[model samples]
Target: MGKLQLVNIEKSYKTGNSSIKVLKGISLEFRESEFVSILGPSGSGKTTLLNIIGGLDQYDAGDLVINNLSTKHFKDRDWDAYRNRSIGFVFQNYNLISHQSVLQNVEIAMTLSGVSNSERKARAKEALADVGLSDHIHKKPNQLSGGQMQRVAIARALVNNPDIILADEPTGALDSKTSTQVMNILREIAKKRLVIMVTHNEEIANEYSSRIIRFLDGEIQSDSDPIEKKDSASINQPRTTKKRDKTSMSLFTALSLSFKNLLTKKGRTILTSFAGSIGIIGVALVLALSSGLSNQLDVMQSDTLANFPIMIDTNEQFVDFSELGPPGSEKSNSKYEEFPEDTTIYAYDYSESFIMHKNVFTDDFLSYVENIENELPEEVNNISFTRGVGVNLLAEGTDGVVKFETMSQNSMMGGFSGPSMGFSHWYEMPKDHQFILELYDLIGENSRLPEAENEIAIVVDEYNRLSTLFLEKLALTEEEYDVTDFVGKTMLKLLPNDVYYTEAENGLFTPANP
Candidate 1:
């Protein structure tokens, strides 16, 4: 009997209105101490099959037997036990905890398996030494290079001394040099322990595995075995390539190797790891603050706005004012001033405002705002602006200049009389009877109206061009003539003869007398 067996497996999932089947009836057998590789293209369900075999997930219908134990009927507790004792897993992402030291990350599996502290430490140290990460015991995940981090993950997987190691794209993220190193270590381990890896790279898989299985569309297409099984009498005899009698280092030996490695570059490793630890500390603080604030807001909002249902209310809304604050307070006010007026700033409001806009805002927009709100200033309130072609302006002077443009036939016919205009207009228009056409150039060639204000703000063709002329018939500098400040404060006043007035709040009369 093989060490692992999958018999008549089938898997399917419900898509919108129909069921999509991935794996058909598939059967396979893998012997102990075998180095096997499952090779396939993307979306071939290689990861899914590996996960099922590793006890990370359940198959819809299958008989999965590992080391003579049937896993198809295993309960949650049984699966956990099986995973701890029977299988080890290595992932492409190197999912090592950044907060934990390299040694600590490796010891996690043994700890979960309830191994003694001394034994776990010794095993983890040994595993690291085997993977050439003995010198990185105290370093966090980010402190090491990508190759070293993956090595740490490998050590973690091996620390528990499981019967089988299941690797999903083990060297997918590593370059050739590092990948070779990793593959060699895995090959060495497979001499005594079974190593089954999922890979897209055929060369690496062929170089390391004695047996290769090709998968397509979630089914095993081909199985090629290099070593043939011996007769019953020779089964008990160890093969030449197999190294069963070779003993792995004990915990003490491993720990000694780890310490010796560390001693070689003590200062350099400590300093680099310390710098990495600082980054981890910063990230931890940020995450903790964000999570804590989010929880507090949730609680406060829940308590205050229980009746409101969707909206929240709070007493104080924090604002970042560094952008608008005095220069000296830039650093101090930066946190508050990060809030943009155009963006909706939401807080834990215990009022009706939350409930009111719940349906008004798009689902995507609300989700985006909710994700960053706790990390950003809370002073932002919902505010929106509507732009129109003409707004009522109260000019200061009695003879204020009134400048207006007639709606084109397209605009009038389409009823685009509101803020949202739909028609287009061209430059170089004929001079009217009453108004003199002073400036009539496009911001750029083929300009759109909404973006026209920003793109066509200045005349690029003419250097030292007169942007505006005063009633005093005096030439003014561009800075003196620029009316951007006036535009924000002023309103538009309609008058006869297609004219309008630019009335400022301070009662200043600037004519758009084009």
Candidate 2:
């Protein structure tokens, strides 16, 4: 409740080349617990005067004071607080948010004042119960008729526990019976606080008001004290202003009210959410595609360059210690010496190659490598073996047995230290038929590998040279012998004089020395 004072209040509006004065120097004072009716015709400044009194509009030149505090001294923030916390309004149109239910409509004001959910619910229910609309709390405004909607507006005004209630033709749109019901609620409210009602009904002003102030041409025509009017029903109650609670709007309250409003119109809410998120989803998809392309490029590069150069040395137990040229210059073995045609076998292209010291390639080595390859990750496709190797062969020819050697070379890099390690006497190991077939691409004049185990194949010139050497050693005539193909020829595979060991079934080692 507030003790409202208007001191010589004046207001105007501009109309092109002229000014129209609305309120003509009105001065008045009002107290709480008084049902004051402001009576006037259309365009007589009734609503303007009510708006000025409620702090909704400003007077051009006058002092409007509430509770002894002049509004001229109030800032914008202070005025907002006063409007939200101290004043309540009841309008002719009901002014209910259409999609919101009765409970949500009533909860709107207190929700803006930072009241918790539980407390707001309890108080909103109590206010609806007072208006006899408790059963329809979940119904929307369109579900109710004129009188019920007006009652809901009344409940919304009462929900905030405001200090003053300002009504502007609150029952103008309803029938006589509904209007009476709405007026009765205002009368009950005026019993405890001030309610300034703007209406043109003379009978209602005389019957229900404690005082009546009439206006004509924007000035007060008559101020009645209820004792002067016939059938005056003013209550002789002492007026007192209630101290106001200081609470402001909070973010949580704003969000809670927004959610309630959105729930009332779900289709509109969904469209709005999509409108805000489309660009974000597009940006995220673009970033994911960029990362996927980068990973694929990396995988392709690794597959192209994963194979490394390896040197398998059959001898490993004894160190030669014989220095040749320098630490970086290694002696080229005579076994890899140039053939009669001074030819080179093109093997592989690698950036840099390493040397591996191993005893020999045997049946056990193949099984060990197969087990190792299975234990690795699936991306490791060619980890077990790379291509290049040197071949040293001793086989039978047209006359008898002969010895020859071949080597695979890569000359891309130079001036690097070769591996220094121990050596042992040379030894030969058994190999799979598929292993020999792979070498046909390099050494066998585009011919296939040896089809039978007893047969042997070599480079084209090496085959011709070995035939000549064997014929020279046996003193055989070249005209009588066929040296075109060696497919059906026999071969004596000779192993070096060295002791080799195999793992026995009893976990003991068995040695074979040749």
Candidate 3:
């Protein structure tokens, strides 16, 4: 017997400063297998009483006993267990998830009870078949008629095989014919379980229910004689069904159910997901753009730096060298008249000055550098030196001639600039002179540095600039001759010092061509 007892049940709500009493001292008892109808007008505490009995809401100052088990010490978890294992709910509005199939709706009770996936699906299909929805098991709620959706709800309520079925207006949304069909299902279910329903229609109540209960103004106006109260005293326990459970709420199960529910409400779920992801999507796009731009800037910087040679200094007072780039970046040379090479004198007189030379760049210095290079963790293939000399270039034609000079300095500006002396020399071309150019940006096409005798690979920057200078010497604009691709087309030859420089009457140096 699905026996239930309530003693002195009290419930109230507070709005503003007033205490609104809903169920004032509601006392009632019920026995098993009775089709009971609760009749009441609006706000007569019928639904509230039903909810309290169903454990959906709590009643203050009440002793509710289910199958002789007092709920006085029952916690929320106990109530939840009662709802899952004992009571089944059927509402007037069906409350079927629109996207879920009839079978899935029935499976919800089992899912919440932590039934195994395979087992729940099988049981869900069985419950639907019992409600004559076996053919529509795969249909969504929206695909069904009002009667069919209500049938699915009934199937769901019965899927757990609960002891007490609390239905509120189960036939309220159906037509007269459909209402009669629903009442038949309820009567059939009441044969084994206790069916307590709330309804306003007196004809349905008087005709279908075995017991009638009337409530008015938060008080029980009438409670009909129990269908068989004497037979219920022997029912000391609720009915039992196999496979029903009081399962604990598992995190994995909760997430799975939540996700399924989300899928049922596709539009709202998609809208909420999109809204939440807006900031994340924006951040990801920003990071992508920033990374791409950073990569491009690194490529540009690498191209600019690759054209120049790497210089290492052993001078103790220096911190860094060549901080500025090529083109107009010449070393500052305003302080000293004499060069460092001239400061070291040898074998001149018997009275010689003692010199304590620190670690400096020398011929034997490279041997020590080689030793250090050998000790490096990475492989070292070759180490060679390319001398940088101070030199100038001349372009001559019928219009006249122009000289492009390279600055050679005497002092280093805290090692922050390249040697003032350029790599080119005015030395005479005796038999053959080979010059190699480091063109960092031209690595993909005709990219070999000059290694053979008399071979030259001129860098594009110097090549284009020299071509522009030759145009200027001819008194012409650069637009007349495109210097964009001037890599392999250029040729060069070395010059002699005496032919390029001459002494003037003022004891100063001058270009020999002028």
What lDDT score belongs to each candidate, Candidate 1 first? 0.64, 0.68, 0.70
lDDT (0-100) at residue 127 of candidate 3?
Answer: 82
Better of 1 and 2 by TM-score: 2
Please report the candidate that would top lDDT against the real structure.
3
Please, what are the lDDT tens digits per residue for candidate 1 over residues 1-514?
A: 4677776888887889998777788777777788999999887778888888898878899687665556655666777777887788999998987766899888867655656678888999999999988788999788898889888888988887888999999898999999998899889989988899999999998888999999999888899973334422233322222111222345764685467656667898799889999999999999999999998986565334422323332224544342333366635433454547777675733342222212245669656755543455353222112223333223333254333333322222111222223222212221121111122233334432333222212222234233232211222233544334333332334454234447668987655553
lDDT of 2 by residue, 373-438 (tens): 467744433322322443334445555544443233321111010111112111221133333232
For candidate 1, the lDDT comes to 0.64
What TM-score, to 2 decimals, does candidate 3 have? 0.52
Candidate 3: stretches off by over 4 Å: 226-246, 249-274, 281-514
C-alpha lDDT (0 to 100) for residue 278 of candidate 1: 100
Task: Give model 3's clash tally.
Answer: 2
lDDT of 2 at 48: 95
What is the alpha-carbon lDDT for the whole of candidate 2? 0.68
Error of 3 at 245 (Å): 6.4
| Tens-digit lDDT track of model 3 for 1-514 | 4378777899998999999899999877787678999999999999999999999888888777788677877776677788998999999999987767788788878766777888888999888888888899888898998888888888899988888999999999999998988899989999999899999999999999999999999999988874355565654343332222356656887898788888767999899899889978999999999999997876555445434435564445422222222456653332434456576654433223223334467778778856754686233322333235555555554466655444332212111122222432222211111111111333445555445655533333423333444445435554744433544544343466777888899998886763
Worst 10 residues of 1 by lDDT: 429-438
